[model samples]
Target: MSFTSDQAVEALRAAGEPTRLRVLTLLAGDELSVMELSRILDQSQPRVSRHLKLMADAGLIERFPDGARVFYRLSSDLAARRLVDMVLDLLEDGAADQDHVRLEEVRREREAEAAAYFEQVAPRWDQMRSLYVCESAVEAAIERAAGPGPFDRVVDLGTGSGRMLTLLGKKARLCIGLDLSQNMLNIARSNTAKAGLDKVELRHGDIFATRLPGQSADLVIVHQVLHYLIDPAAAVREAARLVAPGGRLLIVDFAPHALEQLREEHQHRRLGFSDAEIAGWLREAGLATSAPIALPPDTEDLTVTIWTATRAETAKRSVA
Candidate 1:
């Protein structure tokens, strides 16, 4: 994606302002709302938004409206992205010490809000998710990633509503679902029972330390769960550990986005995740990952991604 002379000049000119440069620095850390930027910069909303509009117009940044709020991030365009990166690299870290400190404060506030929101909305989790992304499409994609598995054992981490259990239960001889919320587990129990999967087992357990034996399951799934965790990579490693030799791990979550309202209203610690980030974690756990499949929404909502990874069959042969 080579930048034309005009595009390069516009981007450089848009980012030339001191305030706009600061905005880019903050956004380089994470996407931010105009209000957030205003607070961090001690400027009025109208004034801050003017700077954002200029940068966004020049393709130096991107603006997305998530429900009632709008957020901005560095442009996803490769040429514009490269320009921002090179320019950011030249800016001294010390120039924005106070801004970073303020950003941390905003981050903590978001975490607290998400935690409180999670407590309030645990019961209607599935229905809420259905409002965001089409479940049928995501489920079909998940089933495809899972393939035909008369698996010996299957494990589902953060199994809210036991939807995964119900979807995969009939295919497994032993099915286990673990979650930190007993209330959610209860909901899962009722859902799985309604599906006539009486043999399915539900446990109130932590995804980060399931305490389940390593390499115990033929299929391990972490569906729509990673975004809530403070340590998603750790959870991925834990999920990978439970995959048996030659078994598969399927992760379903949203692709990278700038949906700020989801963070404020629905307790999403992350807007979404990138392919390289998730694949890197799987690789670190000694699993081979396939190219991720994305299912973009019909509207301006989130895009769901399915990542499938497998433990090498050679590992089993070697151990034997």
Candidate 2:
């Protein structure tokens, strides 16, 4: 048999059991000692050890000696990690019952606190560029769709840091940014001005119900914003509605996952969308769409997915 087949059989056999899968999810984000795993799963140390040993042998987790004790974590194998992430994504949000709800609440509180801290220090946003990786692949996708041009109008939804607009400044004759927070908008305005791009305008708006003109923009870019919305499908529909004939809509966000803890803590609207979900949203919005191109591995914890949609030629006449 081929190595691929052999590996597949082994992986399936190893992950087929519920206990091992649980072990993987527990160790997805951080490491845990055997005792910690036992506590989290409410299982005996011997049972947890048995599961961990199987996963480690299957190359799903690694061991580290800490004095006389050992810690276990999700393995370094990218493929194995990807498998664990996919499986976890399939699990339901309430899988952990009340514990899940409480954890999500705590996560939301922490994220709000962090967002508030960023808001208070909004003036220092420009200096915080080093803290994040500039999503180059998304930038490349937007440039490909919109091209270098003196676009008459442009809309950047969820324009965090106003980075997408700044990236489009070379071509957008008039760029408008819509976001929820006054503080984020303030930072966006300052950043645009500092870049000497006076044609850009910032507004406090929700992507779901913004009053912006429909079918006006030559390019609509929503980068790193959909995952945070409560109704990503609605947000995508709104984004598509903003695209004029011959216009392009660009979306960048995570692929779907079962990580309820991250969703609850981070205020993520959804774990993320898979390629199928992205295609469905674009088609429903009356735009011809493309599959997502995966972002580079080094981007961030969130995977980057790009979908480029162009208004159908007949779409011009179908408008109300």
Candidate with top lDDT is 1
Global lDDT of each candidate: 0.85, 0.71
Q: Give one digit per residue, the lDDT tens place, for model 1 in 1-320.
A: 76789978988999999999999998886767788899999999999999999999999898866445677877868888899999989988699898999988886776567556655677898788688888899999898899898988999999978899999899889899998776788898899999998678899888878988888888999999998775677899999999888899999998888777776566776677889779988998889999999998756578999999999876652221
Candidate 1 ranges beyond 4 A from true positions: 1-116, 316-320
lDDT of candidate 2 over 209-238, digit per residue (tens): 778877888889887777655346778889
Q: Which pairs clash (backbone N, Cα, C closer than 3 Å) in model 1?
A: none
Q: What is the lDDT of candidate 1?
A: 0.85
The worst-scoring run of ten residues by lDDT in candidate 1 lies at: 311-320
Candidate no. 1 TM-score: 0.65
Off by over 4 Å in 2: 1-134, 257-261, 299-301, 317-320
Question: Between which residue pairs do clashes occur in model 2?
Answer: 89-257, 89-258, 107-265
